[model samples]
Target chain A: MKRYLKICMAAMIISGLLLSGCGKKEKQDPDSTSQSGVMKVGMVSDLGGVMDQSFNESAWEGLLRAQNELGIKIGYLESNNNSDYGPNLESLTDAGNSLIWSIGFMMGDAALEAAKANPEQKYGIVDMAYGNNTPPNLISVLFKSEQASFLVGYIAGRMTKTNKVGFIGGIKGFIIDSFDYGFHAGVNYANADVKILRQYVESFSDAAKGKSIANQMYQQGADIVFHASGPVGDGVIEAAKEKSKWAIGVDKDQNSLAPDNVLTSAIKRVDNAIFNIVSDLQKGKFAGGATVVYGLKEGGVDIAPSSDKHVPKEILSEVAELKTKIIRKEIVIPYNAKTYEKFYIAKQ
Target chain B: MSIKAKLTNWSNSAKRYLDNTFVFTLIAIFIGLITGAIILAFAGFNPFESYWAMAVGIFSKPKYIIYTIIKATPIIITGYSVAFAFRTGLFNIGAEGQFIVGGIVAALAGYFLHLPPVIHAMVAFALAVGAAAAWGAAAGYLKARFGVHEVISTIMLNWIALYLSNYLVMSPAVKRAESEATHKILATARIDLFGVWKVSEQGMAWRMENRFFHDLLKPDINIGIIVAILLGVMIFLILKKTTLGYELRAVGFNKDAAENGGINVNRSFMSSMAIAGGLAGAAGALQVLGVSLECVNLSNMEGYGFDGIAVALIGGNTPAGCFLSGLLFGALKYGGGKLQSMMGAPREIISIVIGTILFFTAMPKLIRYFTSRINQKREEK
Candidate 1:
């Protein structure tokens, strides 16, 4: 009996060893390697990574498309924690990527550090680029999202049923505030008497705070609200939909998300910028040494017209004429509160 | 002698098996339930729906699963690095910094040195490991030579390592002057995505290994998985068979008793630390060689080292246990991102869940007591 027990235990141990050996080579998708010729594109996911449908996903979609079309290799490292950022970035770079990209503004410091250390290799930073001292080989692709945001705000002001217009902003920062300022401008242009209700969540990704803020705005008689938040804006839309109030979206074409409630979205077109960078790299026309801003003329920023459902056709036609006027330098859209105050003569 | 031996043997085997099946699962579930509730409550999204969303989001697609494994790779490697140290009773809690050391050193080597693929990759790993091991050993030496507490020493070393890596990146020579990350690691040193798919280029010959699983698994997940498995087998072999493993355990269980058994406690502590540090250093090397051929920006907070503590704790500080725990934790991180998108769960929820798990982990005695009481009631019924 004892001998039998020994035999059984030995068998169990042997099987464990065998299975482990098998698991090592079993290759659970990432565990195996296949060499190829295409320039490998690796991404170190920022605070949110690929799953962040708003920012990181935009970049990821572009890279994944590049992988499929160019037959290039693509991989991404998810930053599990803040410290994982460096290692995750290193992991993708080590994996034979000629270009490594980190998605989001938070990646600026890490990207700046890594890109500077490796001069021969090209790098890209999204959102905020180093305006203080630029790198020669690194591409700092920025967007004048405020320009498009201004146009959307004009639309919201025109469309609001109530005289009180609201701006639910995600934090009080230059990039985010641009959205608020532009929306406020649109509302003011549509009606000088439009009462503006503005408040910030102090967070980019907090939907609860966004909902609460939007609810408060609705309670304050804001029949129409515009949000310049990231994924957190989804909550603003949800609150609007629930209250049957109108809302505007920022970053990408989120107008369709709440077709009945969302009047329009100021498109940042992050995906367009990402695709441009990849395409530029492929064509060897990749420009560096300066900040690359994508504005209206460059097709980097605009309002999503096609996605709008409740927006009147005449209003859309008017927006187009207004867009042309702005593009031709006939009507300059003001973004900063100081600038808006200068044009409209508001006290606060 | 026979009866006494039989009783001891039966209880030992039963206890070992019972611990494996019982301890982690019950505690893990309790933590999961609590974490699940938080997701539903905070985000106003239903918890069950969010969890299902996470599960479906990750497991439903082939590409997503591959991504999940790729995500799990570094965690497993870092977990191994920490667990190796735990075995030696050193608790080299500096794996995060070591992971960064591997990355930056490898990036420097990759960007500067031009060499054959094998050589470039090997050198990067070597340098990273060397840096991490040196860092870990310094802490060990301070403790051994000066009787400094390792817990305090390793923590201090972690901070020093963090600043040093960040300072290097911020430096003009090493920093990506225009960007946030270091310049790309040299071409030869990078882990290839095509290599992950096993597809050859238009002109080049199929260079090396058969890698039949390339189509089955992704490539960037390569070397780390191998390291993790090898570590598990090595730990098992060493613990069950080797003199060093026995001595380390003796000291871990009771230092005075281990000394009475004629083991050199100081040497054991020092050597264990050295081995642990070496493993962490090796992890750093892998971070550069096996994944991204670049250095992590140290200025920003990264958690490989800190998480290593949690991984070791959750895995019960066993090599095999850490392997499983790391995989789960890695999956949790990967899935947490999905919960945010699909179910609107907050990114912070993942930390809450892990923290909750760690909380329950501290109460093993409570779990044992609860389970025994339940068993007694069942028997009476």
Candidate 2:
């Protein structure tokens, strides 16, 4: 009887905690009937939900802006795992969304399959290009992330007092290789004597690993660290706060995470690209079967506004100059090891 | 009739009803629904409408039902693995590792082997099951030889299997060029029903004429669910009728008694683990051949094996119980996503409801206590 009483008590307490803790609910827009001409845009997020504070967040922000400024009806479905991708896309299609967006490169194959199956529906994917085989109804959004990484590298190169900087990547892949090579090129261009330590967390979500790697680099006399490793950068910033060193953010303005310790962010304007594409759809100018690349010249990437707070005025001016050079094609930023070598020889 | 006599009669009937497992399970399910409704209402959504939408999501189309069944297949098999071990008084926490080992072997065999169409898939399935059985038997061997607790050893093996699979997926020899996953398995290794013919032009033309069959085959319709059901029936028979089953159950009841009665206790442990591991490995093989068709680098455990524990508990460690509970869970999972899509409700609510149900189902003692208390109050009155 005592054991029975204990079990009963435990059940009641667990249910009570759940009720009290989950009372705060998210605000949702009331369901509206789809009008004949009103375009409904639906988005499917990857495993990272809309609040990932990175790529997914930026895409969601863009959708919200479209809802406000363009007066379009917008909805989104968050995926729980890889298997959810196809079904989520199908649900949106069945709901009569005129345009659908798949967030992240991980959803590339799913998006492609969905587009092929439903040729009448227009689809777009972020950070994935199908190259020559892009379907007639799909648009691929690509970012010249290397161009943005170069500007932040310039800042780190100019500001480091220890003449040693570090680069932390999420995974060793084509996407991350661009960030690595671009940072290395920028560092060399600014100060040839400065050394850059590099490491890959091999995972985007492992913050503990990221923090440890950043700590080690700082201990090795690196004054600043730059990371392009999604959520792992949060740990890098925390490490920077602890060590009183500099950390550069990626994807969005993350100065709020560590304020004084964060020098700046390499901002990839996914929101801008998404907003522009939706605006094009509104204007009856859907550019399907094509890959749209956004570089510094296209106003798709830039340094965060918070850069001026930490970076010296002269260094900011130099970064602005470098940005112009990249835009004008006067400086060709390397995005891989082989290209980086050629760029290095040309600099010499 | 006096008031006291009538109250006693009512309490007696209520106690009898609570003693029935089926009725008790229904009551637990009712409590879980109420909990979900309360959460939904507090979260600014109409609970009735949300539940209506979830039901519609599952049953509105044949394809949806097919999809739910597809999702339930692997978990059902894994649940059997857990139930099989539990019946023999062994905790098989290593089902996750065995499942991964099976998947890795299946993917390798599917990709590298070039056999006849039916034979290729069968060979891959055989290799996967054998590998996982070996993986499970290793833990049993340690327990028999060195008196190692299976719970700790299996947990450690789970991590090793995860990292080893990851290493294999990343190796250039197995990795697909320009992708994070392995190469898609060869066409000969696919186990989908009419997979090759379904997408052909002639098949599409035929599908246009047969609307029902088209919708039924819309998802990756495979034989996995059928195989899982057959396996459940087979396990039920084996446990009920076989001499081996008697020995395993005897060991589970009392090892010393079983040993004195001439049963080989050590052999029973190894055989029980091997069979459980084989069931888990079959799940991975079927998933590879029927669903994803290749292995992706897993960031974390997929949780199928973990969910198997819940299924086994809810099932009362019976094969039939696992099958039913697996379907229940699969429907909840696949249908729950519709709440977010249709009504903008958060997905975490589904987890809460499932957790609450599992909690109630697991604590039969609390239900018995409440029933007795009610009887006591009635007698006092």
Provide TM-scores for the models: 0.54, 0.89
Scored against the true structure, residue A187 in model 1 reaches a CA lDDT of 70
- What Cα-based lDDT does every candidate model obtain? 0.68, 0.85
- Candidate 1 chain A: minimum summed lDDT over ten consecutive residues — where? A26-35
Q: Candidate 2 clashing pairs?
A: none
Clashes of each: 64, 0
Candidate that scores best on TM-score = 2
Name the lDDT value of residue A64 in candidate 2: 90
lDDT by residue for model 2 (A230-291), tens = 88898999999999999999989989899999999988899999999998999999999999
lDDT of 2 by residue, B358-377 (tens): 88777666777776786579
Worst 10 residues of 2 chain B by lDDT: B8-17
Provide all candidates' interface root-mean-square deviations: 11.6, 7.4
> Residues A1-348, candidate 1, lDDT per residue (tens digit)?
233335546855764575455545434423233333466676767655576646677777878788777767776666654445644454344344667777767677567755654456677777767775777877887877767877777777777777888888765656675677777777777777889998876555568779989989999988878887676787899999999998887776676677788777787777777777787787777776677888887888898765347777787887888778777877666657777676566423
Give the DockQ of candidate 1: 0.05
